[model samples]
Target chain A: MKRFWCLFFMIWPVLALYVCWIAPSMGWWFPFTGPTGMKAASPLGERIDDLFYMILYITTATFVGTQIALGYVLFKGAAATDEGNTEKAWYSHGSHNLEVIWTIVPACVLLFIALYQMDVWAQYRVKDSFPSETKQGAIAEVTARQFEWRIRYPGLGPDGKPLPLMPEPQPTDLYTVNDLHAVVGKAVMIILETQDVQHSFFLPELRVKQDAVPGLDIPVWFKASKSGDYTLLCAELCGWGHYKMKARMVAETEDKYLEFLQNLTKSQNYDGVPETPAEGAPVASAAE
Target chain B: MRSKLVALVLCSGMLFVCGCGRTEPQFSYREGLSPRVQEYVRTTVDEKFGTPHKIRVWDKLPIQAHTALATVGEGSKDNSLVVDISGASRPIEPGTEVVWVGGTIMPRGSAPVTVEAFTKDKNLLSLVAAPPAAPKAGDKIVIGPGQTLTHGRLLYAEHCQHCHGVAGDGQGPTAPYLNVRPRDYRKGLFKFTSTKEGMKAHRSDLARVIEDGIPGTYMPSFKLLKPEESHAIIEYVLFLAMRGESEFQMNNLLASDYSDASVANRIKDGETQEKVIEEFVTRVKEGEIDEEVNQRNEKMIADWVSAQAEDAVIVPKEKRNASDEESIKRGRELYLSGNLNCVACHGESGLGDGVQTYSVTKNTDTGKDNVEPGLYDTWGNKLKPRNLRLGMYRGGRRPIDIYARIEAGIKGTPMPAFGAKLTEQQKWDIVNYVLELPHELRTPGTGVAPASPATKPAPVATTAH
Candidate 1:
């Protein structure tokens, strides 16, 4: 019974560690790889995780070394034969050498980690480093309000070129108001705004999350590596209906995207209606 | 003594360290905390300390292997009943039997018996004799007459006072944000309706609006209420609206005595403040001075409310005249074709599923796209397009009612005021055409000869103010 108890105690910690590492990957804890699931969204996230493991390994080694020293000292003292010749254990008032070594070592380690993270963070946030082709190819604006995200794509202008970003005070040039569609293989700059309260635009797969602040324009940029449908979600708590704010982004080949944009534009204007109608009545009559 | 003292010192030191280092469970749901407080806690903690290892309800203590006593009544007369529940989880479900530690009695003669269950904290979960019986079909919940007033008071405190003001004066906390300020329930003029001139919304119409909600604006749908509950709320809303209107009219009457504009002007010029006050007080006391005026205004408001209610009804006499399946088929073709161009905005499915929806401007009020405010007819007015899928015709859903709207055009809106444009038979054809868009658009039908062309020009309403 004593041997069985000792074995059980030894095996418990190993079993716990096994569960923690393997359960998440095997779908026991997090069953899916989408939003709300535990999987990392971008390659950058994986890289950061790798850095975290490295630091953890170093700290764990230090902890184990100190614990072993403590155990050895306790064992030696327990075995000492004192029998009233009790000279108190030797005591040191201070240890300047030990203090300096501990302090400087930790400071250097922290500085190294901080310096290592700067480049990764900058690469993830800064737009210019992205390939020009990828940047230009997938451009769309996502506006968040209350509990919903509104996506806008710039359509080609009358000159058969992409419309220049309109200056303020000209409400007409805004992509959504003008029914603009983004051409494939072009950069999409999303200008996010909130109508009522605060909301966050989060695209997990793209590793992009930005708060939609009212009365302020927050810009977020992303390039889809492959063309498929992706979900857009509101990560901020706007109101009771926040869960319902959902939209979809469709990425397609450059040719297919252009075809969709042109067809959509043509459908907006019908051929049967006269360009200029006779007096009061203009174009087609049905309004209701 | 020395060894014992050393052992005691070591144990004390160990206790101190354990107590200082132990983690405390976080408690949520403190009273008076704003709803956003929890969100702020979650975000800030995640940003700083990283995610929690696990979350558990901090208030509940885990149950050990034992049974708790269940009591049923107050002191002395309290009866005990045995409920053999053990090692139960926190957040115990109702009807769970806990062990009764005391005596049980069968009641006799005029006295009542009570039963109760307790949590580990000694808080009462329930105090009843037995499980409630299931409700019978067609039987209403009878909570007694006083429940109406209790419910009304609670509803008013929760929803109405925030916008209608504590006194129903339209001076709500959110009043400042609204562009077209909230309706002073007292004046009682509602804008959207099929009502002729003046009218309070039909109780059902008010409930419908509240349930489905206005498409644009801050008014959100309260679709959570059941049918009967919504009716009760509507009643409460009407009560407040009427009470406020009466008060406003009384104030208006006291402020005005208009014998004649010239006479009033002369009196105003010559009279002192005291004299003016005296005259107003005297006129109000006599009750004869503005009786005619007050009566006229009151009647007008009542008539308007009545007219709106009448307009809200769905008349069935206007269903399609012919039973021929062939006519409906022909009508469906015209609906989708370029001649009518209904599909341009309404979409091919007539479910308001057009591609134009993606491009339509967002409504500033409700934050929905495709709700353009300037889509009114020749008259500069605000109009909303119909959402065909809902099938709740704004002007009454009857076949003829829809026919009339299509024929005359909705006066002020983008629903061009279509009577003269399409032929008489074509108008009927379009009606059948719309019905076909949703269910079966591809069906074939026999063609009907076109009716005689409309002779009179389409009548347009006067320009909006």
Candidate 2:
């Protein structure tokens, strides 16, 4: 019983370490790779996945090595105790060459990762590094309040393209409360601002998240290569209403997006002149 | 050997303990549902609505509000009340021949009605509601319960119906146990909407509410739900609201046309109930009833449709009058003003216990004053007027939140809207005064103190635009 118990105790860390290694692939933690699939939807998203896997692989190796070493020490110590020889076993100090190799290898690995992740970080974070298409000015203003997202779209002309940037407010500006609409192939910029408190604008699929500071218009741009809707949720705890900030991103053909804009514009400026020759009033179509 | 054995046991236990994760709020998805309700839901709703799901963008059909003119009853010529609103800065001008604003303008017990109509002399008018159409018996009811419901319906049943109820009546079994009862959507009224005073909530408003669940109540946020699911739930809630409201209208019509008293009288007089029903139908068709019920229905639908239009959210026309001492002083004066009725409920010192707190509970409507006095909400829970000094506002603490509360009054409670009675500046003034109450109480300040210790005036972040 004692021998069996000793063996079991020795293996516990190994099991834990094994579970940690398997957890991500089994969809236990993110970059979730298991049945509950979460995949990269953008270039940055892929880069982030790469950075994550790099850290994960390195961490797993370290974890296994450390745990096995710990288990080996326990096993050897227990064997000594079993023999009733309660003396520190004669141990040799680490070799100078081994120490040099160990230190240099880890340091080199760290250096490589640090240097490799720089561009991905710069492309993702630096405001100026954002795609040039984003500099044409924000296509929408997303004002996040305590519990909801109030989105305003640039007014489009009869040609289905956004009107030119101007210093003044246009009456044709289209507004929708929760849903953010963008053309699939076009780069959309959001001038995110918080009306009351701090909120993070996170689009998990697009790997886009930027804190919307109160009184600051932080520009965040994303271009959806695939045309589909994605979840856009608040990643910050603004208040009790934080969890329910489930807004969505609609990435569709420019025509469908224009139709959505037309509907929104029609709803907001119902009394104003027609922007497009589309149907009577855009039917209260919210679902497409 | 013994040490090894003990170590093995202890090691496994430590391993188990270490595996335990950080604590989180224990949220049950099917919260507070009895087995019976759950089973009934599965059989009735699922079989009928075709299994609930997430709402697609296309599922967001616009809600049309009622906005049709109601015909004045040609018979009630002498029942007009003259409203002297000339003193009120924004006096409502008589529309082009008595247009209906939301629905019918009907006279209720003289106090319950808004101005019915402007006399030709512009002095006397009926209160705003249309004349009560007599209730008639009906067999056809409960439309589309089993039809292909929108994806929102499934999500609503899965998440909301356990507390809100199948009929949106706020009578789910768990309702009785809740302190802040789930909202009853049948009246088509919501408390924390982003809508302006008296305006219907926007679809996005409903969606946000579902996502952000009411913080201090049983309404837990459905944040775990996919965005599509939340949108679907919003649609379903709106659908239920519309359905319940229509049913309420139907009930009103039936009660007016065929009340118990009228039925008893008809039986005593040897007149068949069938005969009365025929007459009622004839009256409806010929537009000979007090007002056309069909027209009122159309108007009701229009009111809902119009609610989807712009101006759903309340925006003050100008920059807010700064919260200076003068404003607070003026607010104090107005709060105690007899017409404002703030003191009657909020108390002289803003402690939330006003003189009317006790009176509001007495059954004046039912004339059962002999019963024990205790204020109860429509949910049948004891109603507590907001403790203004505590400053723990449940709706929110933002100035706009307070503004909305003052202007629209908290729905589902006894609070009455002052938007119709007071100006926007007045509402903001009240907000300032209410916020000041806690501070005044704490330090013996010159002005009104605020409601809670934590209720600091957080700087409002606004768009530079």
Candidate 3:
């Protein structure tokens, strides 16, 4: 019965360790691998990931050390309780030195983590710390409503380059829903606002999140390291249809992005007229 | 101890096995008709379009593509049916039920008869019971619940039924809380459509709404759905809308004479109760009500089909006028001009708080004055004129979109069409001015023109911070 208790106590730690060891390979680790494993998609995201790993290592070491000490003590105590043994079991109220060491150690570790993550935190939240390119202007305005993301981009100018996005919607502004496009490898910013309740803009791949408080214009920025489609989701429970707020961010090359804006302008101004009328044909007759 | 462990393991194993199999939730048709409909009207509609479990799709309706349609071939006999299975989207085997959907020969909408035996080689079917009348050549038949509609029903249940209601009545569980109510498709009136006035919305218009969603409203985009999946859902929505419309027309047919209020009025006017009852029975017996209903149903089907035609769409005769200072100036004049009288509803400053909203108006239903002064749509829901300064256009924000709204007017609303009164150029001018309403700075209270950049007026309520 004593052996059974000792083995039962020891089995839990072994199972926990085994599960942790296989978690990454099973695509169950943090950073939400998505299709790619444990790799952040942005430069700042990489730094954030590094900080996450640092804390994870510290916690893992603490967990294993405590579990091993528990198992060893359990086994030793079980052996001492054998029927043939007559040794006196030593018991103490507490160890002052052990308590002092544990308290100071965790306090120092918490202090270190706080100090280490300050730079990333400032870069993410502090407006002055944003990249110089993003400081110029926001690329688009994202308005989160009941259950959708409405994106508005600046219309292209005569030079075929995008005009500066105005704080107010311009007549030339182009609109799209649930689709946010940005140029890859460049830090771009978006002005986030909510028409109704509170919503959180979460980009899991880029490790970026910001709360879109009503009556406030929040700025959120990220640079995609590689060009691809990533998810944009609302992490906050805004309403009954909160789960329906799913959008995608498409990061592409500069030329492709410009072409997209040009196409949007053309479509937004569509006058029910065909693009090119048949040769020597009347344009008005084509609609029928 | 070993026996206890074995028992524990066996019990857990049974639990795991039980959890393995999952049953797909079945969707059902809406059960009862609206309370406004008479009892006889409900019975007639139900007989023509079966119950929840056994839905009968009328062949003449535009919803035929959603069902598995088969044609009665030349070799069909009194006892056996020879069908062309080309329209059958899903597999059909013995014991499957088939419904005869076409032709006027079979009365009271034929019931679904099961196939006892079938031979694939000869495309022959032997029914367990004979149909009321032999299905002649070119008659339409449906085998089982149509696969497309089945797929559509499942998707609609998951994505749309929460707010659209199972009957597409706009009274879903989450509807009451919304300020701008979800559309009641029973009237077949969509506010934002590319088609001309008095026409049903084109399939593309509805698709765009699903893909882009309506801004300033609770309807969100479901752009992630595959094209085919979206199409199937649209078909299902159309089915519900058409079914609701059919019931609504039938209720109207009897409501004028046989309604509770109408019958009471007749009794007050010195007619015996027995006389009114006798009149209704005679009408039903002579099939006069049925003929009227059939005529209305045929008209509804024709209108829906005609809306799909190319000419039904409103096409601009000329390209849009350039949005310049001169065009904006001309548009502002037209806005305040008595000819357009846009200021009656849309305030002089375009705040949507015009005098019309505060004045008492006649109720169209009872021909009496309304207690509260407000604008009400055909659906009996109170609506406010759009605040143009907010820069939120529900139908759409495109220049051509505004043009269409001006030309055709918003269907099922107080907004009247100016297409006949105004020329194409004049309409374009208003489009330009309305588009610029958000950006144009105006003096508050005075309703004056754009204030000079030097003189600062009271702050306007801008959408932006």
Give the best candidate by lDDT.
3
Ranking by TM-score: 3, 2, 1
* Docking quality band of candidate 2, CAPRI definitions: incorrect
Q: Model 2, range A39-147, lDDT digits (tens) per residue?
A: 6666677788888888988988887787778777777766887656878776987699989999999999999989999998787667768788776677777878756
The DockQ value obtained for model 2 is 0.04
Off by over 4 Å in 2: A1-6, A9-37, A84-87, A91-104, A164-169, A270-288, B1-465
Candidate 1 local lDDT, B16-65, one digit each (tens): 88888766322221122222322433332233222122211111111111
Q: Write the per-residue lDDT of candidate 3 for residues A1-288, one digit (tens) a residue.
A: 887988898898889989989998887775553333368888999999899889989999988898889989989988997889998888788999999998999999999999989999999877778899886677889999889999989767656777677766666678899999999999998888899999999989888898888988888889988887888889999999999998988888999899888777767766665545543332211011
Question: All candidates' TM-scores?
Answer: 0.36, 0.45, 0.79
Best by TM-score: 3
Tens digit of per-residue lDDT, candidate 2, span B1-465: 999999999999999999997753211113222233224323322232222232221112343111111333323433353333222112233331232223333345433223444554554455455334321122111111212234455666656666677667777766767777778776677777656666676676676566555543556545446665565466567666655554455445555446656666776889786776666657645755425434555565566666677766665543345566677888888899999878877788787788866763554235455244556654345666777775445665446667767777776566777777877777767776766665565444445442222112122223334
Error of 2 at B342 (Å): 22
* C-alpha RMSD of candidate 3: 8.7
The candidates, ranked best first by DockQ, are 3, 2, 1
Q: Candidate 3 lDDT, tens digit per residue, B1-465? A: 999999999999999999999663222233343233355665676666543345566767776444356788898887588887765434465667777767526767567677777777888877888888877988887776555667777888889888887777888889998888988888777888888988888877888889888888899998877776778787777777777778777766677776677777888999877888787778878998889998988888888888889998888887777766677778889998999888888888898877778888666666677778987677777888889988888888777788889888888887878888888888888987888787666666533243122122112122333
Superposed by TM-score, candidate 2 places the C-alpha of residue A46 at a distance from the truth, in angstroms, of 0.7
Listed in order, the DockQ scores are 0.03, 0.04, 0.25
Query: Which stretches in model 1 have alpha-carbon errors above 4 Å?
Result: A1-16, A26-94, A126-138, A158-162, A167-188, A259-288, B1-465
The residue ranges of model 3 lying beyond 4 angstroms of the native Cα positions read A1-38, A72-89, A277-288, B1-55, B64-145, B257-286, B364-366, B444-465
